[model samples]
Target: MSKDYPALTRDIAQYTGELRKLVPETMHSFYALSRAAGANGRIDAKTKELIALAIGITQRCDGCIGFHIKALHGMGASREEVAEVAAMSIYMGGGPALMYAADALRAFDQFDVPAV
Candidate 1:
C-alpha cells in the first residue's frame, strides 16, 4: 500500500514537539547534534541530506525516509539524485533496503508538489 508521507512527517513532527516538551534538554541536545551533523563543512547540505536519506532507507525507518525526502525536495534534489541514493542503499542493505528505498522514492514524489 502507498503511504501518506506528508501526513506521516506531520504526525511525527507533532509528536516530536510533544517529546521536546517532556524532555527539553535531551531534545535540545539532539537538535543541536542534528544541526551540527547537517551543517555544511567539506560536504554541502544537499549531499549531506542525500547521505542521510540513503542511511534512512538502509535502516528502514519510515519517519527518516519521509523527513529526509522532504528535506531533499526542499533542497532541490532531483528525482534522479534520490534514485541513485536509493540504489546505493539497496546495494548495501539488500532486500529490506529495497523496500524502504521504494518508499523513499514515493516520499520524494509525494513532496514533489508544492510544499505543505
Candidate 2:
C-alpha cells in the first residue's frame, strides 16, 4: 500500500515513543513471510541486509536505513555491498532512494564498531 511514509512514521512514533515498537506489529504478514524466506534457505544474512536496504530506500525511512546498515555490517557486509544495494535501489525506486541510501552509507561510516 502506498503511504506518505513521513506521516506514518510520525504517527507510529508519536504513539509508541519509538519506531521499533511499531515494527513487528505493523506488518505481521510481511514479517511472517520474511522469517519464512530464511527457513532452510541458502539466502544469507548479508543478502537480507541488501533487501532491507532496498526496502528502506524505497520507503524513505531514515531510521530503517541506519538500522539496516548496522545489520549489514553485523552480517559482515562490506562498504561495497552496501553501495551495491544502493545502486540497485536507484534503478527500481528512482531519485528518492538516493537520499535514503546516502543516509545508510553515512550511518555505516559513522556508527561505532561493535565490541568483538
Best by TM-score: 1
- What TM-score goes with each of the models? 0.96, 0.64
**What is candidate 2's CA lDDT for residue 84?**
86
Alpha carbon lDDT at 104, candidate 1: 90
10 residues in a row with least lDDT, candidate 1: 107-116
Q: Compared with the true structure, what per-residue lDDT tens digits does model 2 show for residues 24-66?
A: 5666665677678634458775687688788988898876776
Give the alpha carbon lDDT tens digit for every residue of 13-74 in model 1.
99999999999999999999999999999999999999999999998899999999999888
Runs in model 1 deviating more than 4 A are none
What are the per-model C-alpha RMSD values against the true structure? 1.1, 6.9
